[model samples]
Target: MAVVLEVDSVDDPRIDDFRDLKAADRRPDRPGGKGLVIAEGTVVVRRMLDSPFRPHALLGVDKRWQDLAPELAAVEVPFYRASAEVMAEVVGFHLNRGVLAVAHRPPERDFDEVVADATTVAVLEGVNDHENLGSMFRNAAGLGVDAILFGDRCADPLYRRSVRVSMGHALRVPFARVPDWPGGLGLLRRRGFQVVALTPDPMAPTLATALTGDRVALLLGAEGPGLTEEAMTAADVGARIPMSAGTDSLNVATAAAMAFYERVRAS
Candidate 1:
């Protein structure tokens, strides 16, 4: 069972993982660094508790502790109870969510492991924005995307902003990094996936027409630049969402949602 400890000081080293959250250099959740996963809010915290990332400790107000009592009944970690003012001081911001849980990142699954049973997958390239990456994970979860594949230059999906925006779906969804940019796409093709690249070019076939394979891999790039020519060529086909004339293009996450919805609609 979890032990609830009342915390009166902002400088408590026991809650150090939840401290200096906004400090880019010292934050424990940064990728390629300490690699901890931080879950904010009750919903995300609940999801984190149920996910593979095990929470080491939690910092929240009393109300949050009561709200989460059922979920934490079996958890053996410490729950540091603090005032909202003290939490704000410790985290360097006014966190309205009133709850935060810090978990250590688990080992990453291999590409083959993540896709072994997937029928619909999202492949991302140059998606460096944490919010966009989070939204994509949220959309993928909502639309039933089986897994996510990271190509070149994508941001860490476990980044704090991404995890918050994903509403904890980032921790639930299966994802893996593809080792070598466009070249790694060949592995998917060899595994019998129809790699389709989403693009803004009107010359390409609509998603409805292009995404016809039983096992599909949808490739998406950054919003403005879209997919690279090399990536487009690597894919079996290029697909676009039908849009009204004169609109520039959809946001990367929005575009991904549309494609994922199309897959659902088709199914």
Candidate 2:
């Protein structure tokens, strides 16, 4: 069982991992960063505890600790209990979520291993927004998408904001980086996945008609630029979600949700 330690002082060195979160050591993508995966709020913290990213410590208000007590019974880490005021002082802001957990990132999953049993997956390119990535993972989890594969210029899915926005689905849903950009997509193709690129172009076939494979990989790009021409060329087909005549495109995450729903609807 985990140990409960009372933290009355904001300067306590024991809770340093929960302090000054804006510092470089907290940002996994920045220089000299510790690459720690931070889960905020009771819900996300619970998900982190259940995920492969094992949390080493947790800091939260008494109420939040009580809410999480059942789940923490099997956990071995220290649970630092503090007042909301002291938590705010230590973390450098008022955190309404009332809880935080920190874990070291596990080794990245292998591309082949992630896709080995996946019947449906989403491949991303240049989708840099952390919120969008989070929403994408949440949508994938809810809609039965098997895994997510990253292409070129994509944001780190384990980033703190991404994990929080995902409601912790970023930790639950399996994902791996696809090497060599569009070229790496060939691995999916060779594995018998029909790569379908989502686009705004009206000339392309609708998703309903374009998706015909037993195994499918949907390719999506950044919001403004959409998929690069090279990525489109690599796909087996280009498909579009029907939209109102005036709108040129949808938000990347929204578009991804629609495509994911299509896959579920078909299955």
- TM-scores of the candidates are 0.98, 0.96
- TM for candidate 1 is 0.98
- Give the alpha carbon lDDT tens digit for every residue of 1-267 in model 1: 899999999888999889888988988888766888999999999999999989999999999999999999989999999999999999999999999999988888899999999999999999999999999999999999999999998999998999999999999999999979899999999899999999888899999899888899999999898888898899999998998999879889999999999989845
Per-residue lDDT tens digits for candidate 2, residues 66-170, read 999999999999999999999999988899999999988778899989999999999999999989999999999999999999999888888878999999999
Q: How big is the positional error of residue 29 in model 1, measured in Å on the Cα after superposition?
A: 0.9
Q: Where is the poorest 10-residue window by lDDT in model 2?
A: 23-32
Candidate 1, residue 71: the lDDT equals 96
Q: What TM-score number comes out for model 2?
A: 0.96
Residue 178 in model 1: lDDT: 93
Residue ranges of candidate 1 with Cα displaced over 4 Å: none
Q: Lowest-scoring 10 consecutive residues by lDDT in candidate 1?
A: 24-33
Query: In lDDT terms, how accurate is model 1?
Result: 0.93
